[model samples]
Target: MNIHEHIEKWQVEDGVHLFDKIKLPDNSVLIDFGCGYGEYTISLALSKKHSTVFSVDKDERMLKIVQDKIESHSITNVRLIKADGTLSIAFPDCYSDMILMYDFIHGNTQEKLPIRFKFFEEARRVLKPNGILSIAPFECEYLRDSSGKRRRYSLGMLISEIESYGFRYSESIDGAVHFDYYHSPYHWKKLNGEMSFDYLEIGPVMNFYKQK
Candidate 1:
């Protein structure tokens, strides 16, 4: 589907309602980390007229797509940044009111624990004194073993990891989230070589607040 088509689908699928649940602040700077193709970026940008969004991604191609969509839709509140994958952020300390980590944390390598630690540290440093961090984990597929069996984690496990960095669990919406293409929608073929489009799965969205 084209970008417009995807945006249309999102609107029809409770995108506005889901964003409303996040309670993004107006007249504030927000960051969408690891944003692919600007689905949530665009949604957040248009959600509040006074809010400015920094859409960061490591992929230049995806950044370009975001730029194209922003230009096509005449959206001026979003700034696209090509991420360097480093723990350091160029912004000043306590700069952003909100930081979004959606469907991308599972991509971390299990061996590189320090890098992950530094990432949360940097996130805490850049977040405003009372800013919030929102996360939407992809699925259990990201937690599978070598044999493809799912490794389950309690909500406390996820909460403890983030809280260890000095954040507090605020609230969460545990239900099916309608995903845009970059987060979901995989195509797989059946044993008979027939193609199927019903391959993507949805996950829950969790929110956390930074402690002073």
Candidate 2:
């Protein structure tokens, strides 16, 4: 599918429902961390006219694509940033209403944990009190530690890791496609079938909140 088709599916077909399920505030300041091609960034910008959205990525090329989209649509509420690293996020403490970490947590090697850890710490610092921290680590793979051993991080483990950085686990939302980057039979079952489950170990997006 072309970018236009993908954007349509995201806005009209699936992505809107996903953000809706998460109860994204209509007038919040959102930072799309590691935003690739501005899928969630653009959707959230259009999701509410009063809200401000920042699309952040390490790749200039990806940011350019999002810039093109924003300009073509005349979306003034969205901003683009080329990430040098998490330390370069540039937002002041408690500045944003939410930080989005979607499809971006893979490739965490032992040597990379400190950097990723700093990223999470930055996420915590930038969010306002009671601000949301939304994460959907779609690549549910084993994470490597300093010793080079791989550890299979379950949903609980993932939550624990995030909470270790001073955030509180809130809730998880199911049945919404994660920007077409993630899908699971678990969500499909709950959406189409009679299966009634409060939470799935391997599906949906996880949510957290900054307590302080």
Best candidate per TM-score, number? 1
Q: Candidate 1: which stretches are off by over 4 Å?
A: 1-7, 11-13, 109-114, 140-152, 174-199
Q: Which 10-residue span in candidate 1 carries the lowest summed lDDT?
A: 187-196
Model 1, residue pairs in steric clash: none
Model 1 per-residue lDDT tens digits across residues 56-160: 998999999889878876888999888887766667899999888887656543533434456678889999987988888664243433343346756677678
The alpha-carbon root-mean-square deviation between model 2 and the true structure, to one decimal in Å, is: 7.0
TM-scores of all candidate predictions against the true structure: 0.79, 0.77
Residue 23's lDDT within candidate 1 is 74
- Cα deviation of 67, candidate 1, in Å: 0.9
- Considering every candidate listed, which one attains the maximal lDDT? 2
- For model 2, how does the per-residue alpha-carbon lDDT over 59-160 read when each residue is reduced to its tens digit? 899899889888876889988877876455678989988888876665445454534566777888899998988887676567754355567878888888
lDDT of 2: 0.72
